[model samples]
Target: MERFVLTDAQWARIEPHCLGKASDPGRSGRDNRLFLEAVLWIVRTGSPWRDLPSMFGNWSTAYRRFNDWRRADVFKRIFDAVSDEPDMEYAMVDATIVKVHRHGQGAKGGLKARP
Candidate 1:
């Protein structure tokens, strides 16, 4: 399987936000980059944690770390850190008219039909 590789520029932006760095007080993570890539692989392929490749290390460990980061809101911080201003060039939602069902519209006689 082709692994995801972070470009030097991309890594530079993401490295500081990662937990378990050498400078951090607690035990350092084995390899933040590899862990991130493993996560990316799982997300990109939409595979279960058990299907993670052996090269990425134990799936359970990776999953645990992922949960830790998620609880800490690390992913949101990373996105905010690295993202640029939103591009609104293209319309995200169409202006096409949508039919919405009114409350009790389908009832037998109308709003008073219900007993």
Candidate 2:
């Protein structure tokens, strides 16, 4: 089977979960694939939103989408969904202290620090 730029299966997986109506509802045939791609591009390159390529359909649009998702807590939800469950049984490690450094705070003052 030929691969689509935006695979239908992947689109289906995320489509239902995406929130918000595209800004231009009158001409609202906005594609979520582009939005997702823009977000990925921003993250992968760590670039400013204004630097997004024109092919992503205006940097302002992508920025608006990014801000909307951020305000709506969508990214947090997605992160939680994809992350492994927290290790509740994880334990904190405490160790006996050993002096590794001999740095002195005015050693001539003859004051010893209390532990």
- The candidate maximizing lDDT is 1
- Give candidate 2 misplaced runs (Cα > 4 Å): 1-8, 21-29, 84-115
lDDT of each: 0.85, 0.68
Model 2 C-alpha RMSD to native: 7.9
lDDT of 2 by residue, 73-111 (tens): 877876664444556675555554443344554345545
Number of colliding residue pairs in each model: 0, 0
Q: TM-score of the candidate numbered 1? A: 0.72
Quote the positional error of residue 72 for candidate 2 in Å: 0.8
Best by TM-score: 1
Tens-digit lDDT string for candidate 1 (1-115):
3545777788889999999999989777799999999999898999999999899999999999999899989899889877765567764665454544655467565456668
How accurate locally is residue 34 in candidate 1, as Cα lDDT from 0 to 100? 92
